[model samples]
Target: MSRPTFKRILLKLSGEVLMGQGQYGIDPETCDRVASEVKAIVDSGVELCMVVGGGNIFRGLAGAAQGFDRASADYMGMLATVMNALAMQNALEKAGVDTRVQSAIPMASVCEPYIRRRAQRHMEKGRVVLFAAGTGLPFFTTDTTAALRAAEMGCDALFKGTSVDGVYDADPKKVPTARRYDELSYDRVLADNLKVMDASAVALCRDSDIPIVVFSIRDEGNLAAVVGGEGTATIVRKPQA
Candidate 1:
């Protein structure tokens, strides 16, 4: 058996992943499946942190476009993330994994609020901490939050689990022939305008010198594979000398 490549990881999940068969709601099946995968990973001795997107339930920017206040809309998006985080927390605990939901926005009535020192303690105690609310501010996507958390947590890798398995030269959905990159330079990802993540998020990871592992989480066990350095991902890091 091969050794796991990381001691710790920060997983960024899209809110749409929780929707399952529903158009805009939490799907118990999807949550349970994800929880199962996470439990499997935890059993392998990896510390984990998570950041979930709120696009499935709501996107503040979408509301802003509909003539609503942009900041208010973003706050709403943040709240949606809290809901997803709580749902995920429930699933993980049911799977027998210790999990914590730390919200950027204070909601003491439910989960704990984001506190750097306390979050570190949670990880050291072998609990998976989920970060929600997008930096607790407007105009920043959860991608940046993932990148920021990975750097702060000093994780070995930042895994962006998306619908696609890897970053493509073009949108594979639109261009079937779009070329995929097994390895990519941080500079190139930004210059080409690849949809892997937002410029701010990619830039943060780049500056922090953390590699972003892009992979598909739909298939069971892929997360474990990527974390184990099985080479089933697009690894984005600094260019070689």
Candidate 2:
């Protein structure tokens, strides 16, 4: 299959990815490696935006299960994302990549608040924009934020970089025979209960007519290869008529 050229893309990274070999928290070396991968894409002329999750630090659902109020737990998760964003910003800057961190929750002292036009300007000026804090509200995942931001920023696609290389019919780790899909449709994903992303995020991307590229960030240099359509991944979008 041919890969569609994406001039602009929003890369969604899970917080777990930053954990590296540890059980929790961000690893500086991991952040640096990811930053270098991002820099490669930016240097290759792709306008980049990013959204990183906070599961490694604080998970809203887990906190709620342990007795914390759902909203408050989610707020904590949002703060965790801010920390991750700052770490990423530092790494990107050290790599000589112009980067900005925009928070949905508006902590003016730490980073700039989310402004569509301002973000667009940053990308136009060849700077990478890191969107943090998950829509500044409770009950939303960074997945949804990535989708929403991708649409709002007029990004051509949403690149979901996870541990697995692509979407599969079942848990590949548990089910050794699980089938990996080269492509998928939004409706099929929802109908089949595929865990490529959360339902709301999938629906939003579907509604916005934006494709979601699921690929592995664990493989060094894979992001650049996937963006160039030479690496393994699953492209989820509307089925061709």
Candidate 3:
């Protein structure tokens, strides 16, 4: 199969990825490693942006289940994402990559508020933009935010960097025989209830005609390899007629 080339892409990272081998919170070394990988991508000339999840610090749904109001819990989750974004920004800057953090919730004291045109300009200037706060709304996951931002930025693809290499028919960790898909149609993924991403996020990408690439970020150099279409990953998009 021929590789799909992308001029621009949005990377969606779960907060747990920054935890390294620890049980919780961000790990500085993990952030630096991810930053190095991102620097390589940016230096390779791919316009990149990112949305980091906050599940590691405080999952809104989990908090809601523990007695917090759903809205309040979700807001806390959003703040956690902002913290993750700042950590990533620091790592990227330390690695010599110009970076910007924008929050939908508009914490001007810390980072810039998200502005579409301004973000576009940042990418045009070869800077990486980290979008935080998940749409400034309750009841939405960072997966949905990643899809929305990818569409808004006219990204060529949405790259979901997770612990697993690709989408599996079952949880790969629990099911040793789980089948991994190299490519799947958006309809197939949706109908099968595949865990490539949140249903809303997958649907948005489908509507926008943007492909979602699911791959492992834990492995060094996987991001670049996947971006070049030479790594173990799954591509979800509309099927060719």
Candidate 4:
């Protein structure tokens, strides 16, 4: 099945998922599974870009809120993301998918610096590009980085690969009666203050006219399923019939 929804997509993954059953750090099994899902998506012929979050290693915002220097903590967070990105790149390549790691902070010895043209070119050439470094600034979340990269790369939609299947009226874990939405408008998300992502990221995506598809990355084969129009996630976009 082919999704009538999107063509090229930017997949945003939280590094915590790569930690598997552990509290932190990359678990090889989890990375392999993630890589397998990614392989399936590439096999479907959909051009893809990736953005990774560093929560598994460190959360700069959380530290800053707890009295840590915002800039220094954020820099550590960026470095954490780079580590996660490199791990993911290694996994993907092991799974036989050509992948590139691009960092917003210049690190030519390790990965290429974030370059719009280069990323686009990589996707055009059937390579998956992993964007790291969280906008190369402190006080910005990876969610915003995803939206920014999606808009800049001309992605058809942004796919947030989370643990939950989709956005809910309340935290599904806490509220058994929480209602799951199959589809929603960006305006509705904003008005209701839904928690799919940070407000800045949602606002940026809305302004850029980018639809966001939220789904569980841990689900086996879900990535390919979503790209094939069989996802059981929520689609947030401009109003449509």
Worst 10 residues of 4 by lDDT: 1-10
Cα lDDT, model 4, residue 79: 94
Candidate closest to the true structure, highest lDDT: 3
lDDT of 1: 0.89
Candidate 4 structure, TM-score to reference: 0.96
Question: Runs in model 2 with CA error above 4 Å?
Answer: none
Compute each candidate's TM-score over C-alphas.
Answer: 0.96, 0.99, 0.99, 0.96
lDDT per residue (tens digit) for residues 127-155 in model 3: 99999999999999999999999999999
At residue 168, candidate 3 shows an lDDT of: 95
Candidate 2's residue-wise lDDT over 126-191, tens digit each?
999999999999998889899999999999999999999999999999999999999899999999
Model 4: per-residue Cα lDDT at residue 86 = 96
Clashes of each: 0, 0, 0, 0
TM-score of 1: 0.96
Write out the backbone clash pairs for model 1.
none
lDDT of each: 0.89, 0.94, 0.96, 0.90
Model 3 root mean square deviation, Cα atoms: 0.7
Please provide, for model 1 over 1-241, each residue's C-alpha lDDT reduced to its tens digit, 9 standing for 90 to 100. Answer: 2223878899999999899768998998899999999988889889999999998888988999999899999999999999999999999999999988999999899989899889999999999999999899898989989999898898888999888889988888999999888888899999888878889999999999888889888877898788888846798888766
